[model samples]
Target: MKSNFRHIGLAKLCGWFGISRQAYYQYNWETISSTLEEEMVLMQVRDIRSRHRRMGTRKLYEILHPFLLENQIKIGRDGLFDLLSANHLLVRRRKRRIQTTNSYHRLRKYPNLIREMIPTAINQIWVSDITYWKLGEIHLYISFITDVYSHKIVGYHVG
Candidate 1:
């Protein structure tokens, strides 16, 4: 691969780079070996995805962790993500609404009296929101409570 870099032979290129020709060949071999490793990992991922189509990268790394350890493959979660992205194997994420608020309920809707009012004390007003995080083929729902004045997360729970 280095030969086509220019009209010059790899030997001359190696000389110009001030490195041995063996080093150049070794570098190419290492690149090939690394590419092969990634390809192997991709194969395993495809096999896993056949059964679990919507798996996300984090869980993929967790499942592959044992296999990678057993096979002497050194790859991190981000590296695997990059590889999956390069191969167009990465799963696309979709947002889902959990209907945290039911507008059609019989209870009266409360008006925002404090909409423009700033909280004077930490406990004067507390705001709560629901956050959704995608995990593999599942979605994790977390609710958090924050003190309006302090802007601090006082409590959180995952459902």
Candidate 2:
């Protein structure tokens, strides 16, 4: 059965199964090591990532160094980074901030409606505002209409 399922070569088998040649090679390769050390490193990485989900590799390396030393487990920073990245535990970069404020309109500005007055009933007044958000190359305008009395979003439109 195994011979029937296997092809003449790894590349041929990978091609027959519609798998990437590179992926097939990687799958066949094995790294046998002390499972105890691997588990310890993984647990440390998991705990650090859980506590600080936004921490990068360098910071995590510094944090893990002391703990690993305490347990007499030695692992290089580059190796730790590789381990974290391989296991999909590395932090992703945050998106750059895009300014949405225009302040270029010529329309006359209206006076403040609330004037620090607190509404005690629903529908006492409605406050609305417009903001811009970047979507790809085009700028989108989002308008929000909210009821000041209940602090609820009554209406919203995006264009």
**Best of the candidates, lDDT:** 1
lDDT (tens digit, per residue) of candidate 2 on 51-153: 8889998888898888888987768988888877888888889998776567679988778868988888998889898998766899888899999878899
- The lDDT of model 2 is 0.81
Name every residue pair that clashes in candidate 2: none
Candidate 1, run of 10 with poorest lDDT: 1-10
Best by TM-score: 1
- Assess every candidate by TM-score: 0.57, 0.41
Residue 133 of model 2 has an lDDT of 71
Once fitted onto the true fold, the runs of candidate 1 whose alpha carbons sit more than 4 angstroms away are: 1-9, 98-159
Give the root-mean-square deviation of each candidate in angstroms.
8.4, 17.7
Off by over 4 Å in 2: 1-34, 100-159
lDDT of candidate model 1 versus the reference:
0.90
Q: CA shift at 11, candidate 2, in angstroms?
A: 31
| Cα-based lDDT for every prediction | 0.90, 0.81
